[model samples]
Target chain A: MSDAKLLRDELRKKYLEFGLEAMSDEEVVRLVLSLSCNEFDSFTEKLIEGFGSLKSIEDADPQALVRYSDIGERSAVLFRMVSEISRCLAVKNVKKGVYLRTTADAKSFFAPLFTDHREERLAVVCLSSRLKAVAPASVIAEGAAASVRASCRRITALALDLKADGVIIAHSHPSGKAVPSSGDCASTELLASALSRFGIALIDHIIVAADDCVSLRETDIPLSFRDRECFGYKITKLL
Target chain B: MGKGSIHSGHRDRMRSRFLTLGSGGFSEHEILELLLFYSIPRANTNETAHALIERFGSLENVLAAAPEELMTIKGIKSESAFVIRLMHDLCKRYSATSDVSADLSDDEKLEGFLTEYFSENHGNVCLLLDMTPRGELRSTKCLPTSSLLSGELGSREIAELVVRNGFVRVVIGQCIDGDKCIPDASCYSLTRLFAETLAPLGTELHDHIICCSGKCFSMRKNGSFSFGSGGNHE
Candidate 1:
């Protein structure tokens, strides 16, 4: 039998016998595409190698789907479309509200923004006194541009401009991990102090890496981390 | 003491705190310091974390930064920078699963699921979501307004698509510009017609949704040609 035929037969058996939940990423993709074993092995290996993992493949640009995997434009477009639709479906299922409820709320709201985004992005959501979003979350920063290194001066200025009573700041990590960096700690403090100067509360500083969002406040991070930093720029900015 | 052994105690202490309180247990700087212990080994992550926060301005910025940019930090080696990137990445990469838990299958959630497609574009969008009788989603097929207008697509056109896609149950949708999602007579008549047409092909019309922006109204929810008796409507 042809390599394609063997793959199709196995997939048919899998679907009939086990279930989709038991299938690996490569198996699912192979079953969907109906590629031969050789094609499947090569495509899966190359795609996984180029992108970080099976889950991470969806994060790659559509062009990468074609260039790296040797899939035709039509298939690449289909892959992109399917992945995008999946993300949309996930976002749609969440409860809709403007209020900053919990870290889970922030996570769902920000997940769509990081979908396959290649460069880092900074999003600032201004909130009313009730913690409801006053306006659509705005992308105040991106890539290597000036905004990426958001100055405390400008960030605070934006809060005042928006007339926001509270603000939640978020950013994407294209690199897949959502762990906060030292810079993330320093900037959140800087921005928090700057926002506080005008009595605008900083509700949270969220880190969106790949698909996960973590609010610094929700994590109950150790307080000692804050003690040492207070002696430096935060005090100067507060003054 | 060896380098790894030196930080081991602090690592265990910090890990214990993280295990107990999650982010509640540590400040943002402590969070970064804890993360750094993995990559830098013997180095003083406390000082490194502080230095990084000082250089990058905040923990959020540091995580969002590219690895190459992170490497520019004085004590951060390539290995540590990559690890930092991973720490930030692990959250989003895992959450991207979009599991659509069992509880989110209500009318509002169902419509909300369809509305996500509309939020990305403004046009007469059409979608066919195939799902099992248990309300588990199978696949979603979309026809953009650029390809075929939702209002313009006839029963035969859409019914043929249903048959071609090999689905027994299908929920259809179209996007409009305005917010008021009151399903018009045309929506009812088209769904009624589609139900009659799809009935012959052994396919069931689950729902027809009219969506605008992030809001959507379901024809099925509003009882537009209820399809209780298989594909054939008496």
Candidate 2:
């Protein structure tokens, strides 16, 4: 018998013996795509049960499916392809121009920020005239009580770059304790000063810790330096 | 043929068949498969192994997932989650307690453990262990710092613990905070101390790891705290 014929016969036998339960995730995909909508629905349900859920089947790695007794390479690849499509479809729905106005909004905004990190990160959230999010919300600097000097510069540059009317500097305490350090205070002061030079307001410096937040603007830390303008040698003016 | 020879021949055949069936082996996947062996008695776990990798995106991601999160999978029960978490525990054991159990020097064991154990904690934590090389009772504390532990851990009081406890090695590990590649200050200081304090004792101060959320980064591996573009270690 020809190779193709032999393969078909073997697959047929396995289908008869194992039912759909034994069919590979790939075969299931092929059958579903080829079938009419009603048939596809039935097959999909069967698949959901066998594989446990849509997420499991959707998230299943193709190579793993091939390890099944009757599954082959083609089946696994097709299964993975379907899941990829689902992911693309899911992400495609989110549009830009969305503004974060609340804690939930901030959480959603920062969700992607912490998705794949391995270190605690600090970012400065700059806001435009409409309080919309401007680009570059982070200033990269490190060390325990490490100076946030670089962060100040980065935040100022972001504010200037985005031409924002005001800015909120934010940093994450990956340790989950959202308390602001003295370094945070110093950095916020520096950033506020730099932003004011461009007529940008430093509205808040928020520290995000594991599960809480600390707003420095709410505290008694010095914010008046932001009002002082040192233009040159003898021109020290408090705006 | 002697009776011993006959028994040996039978054992060899069984071994070959076991190898062919790929039922028992020491491959990384096999180790992962075995992790679920206790929970899944009847089914082959190769597919589950691949499923976990696909679902989570990588092996490290799987290990990094919370046991609660892992139990959300369809086929996974509480027992399975426990088993999976145990693999991480086992790896941690290899790094922190293995040397002592093997009767190696405390300092040597600590160094070896740091290299091996800390690699698995892809998230940042400040671990305060109170145990001797011989598995003696000591104080144990775990402070999850996400990806920063340097400042909280950099105090002289902590340093004093290193000297007093005679810690042969110390690990300052972190979980990558996010796309914020700004290195964590606490992690940096903690690692610096980890290197300095453990070194003089002839104990190897292994790399302080910044676990990028799902995987780990060895400061020693990256050469410095400098993070890559879009890597979020900043």
What is each candidate's DockQ, to 2 decimals?
Answer: 0.01, 0.02
Best by TM-score: 2
Residue A7 lDDT in model 1? 69
lDDT of 2 by residue, A181-209 (tens): 77777767776677777898776655654
> What's the TM-score of each model vs. the native?
0.32, 0.33
Q: Give me the runs in candidate 1 sitting further than 4 Å from their true place.
A: A1-97, A146-151, A223-239, B1-234
The stretch of ten residues in a row with the least summed lDDT in candidate 2 chain A is: A230-239
Interface RMS for model 2 = 20.6
lDDT of 2 by residue, B1-234 (tens): 976666446434533332222211223344345445446655656677767766886444666678788877666777677545533432332233322212222334434444343444322334444332222222222343421242433445444545543443334434344755335776676666555555555444444555443444566556774322111122
Cα error, candidate 2, residue B186 (Å): 44
**Candidate 1: tens digits of C-alpha lDDT, residues B50-83:** 8888888766677768878888878888767755
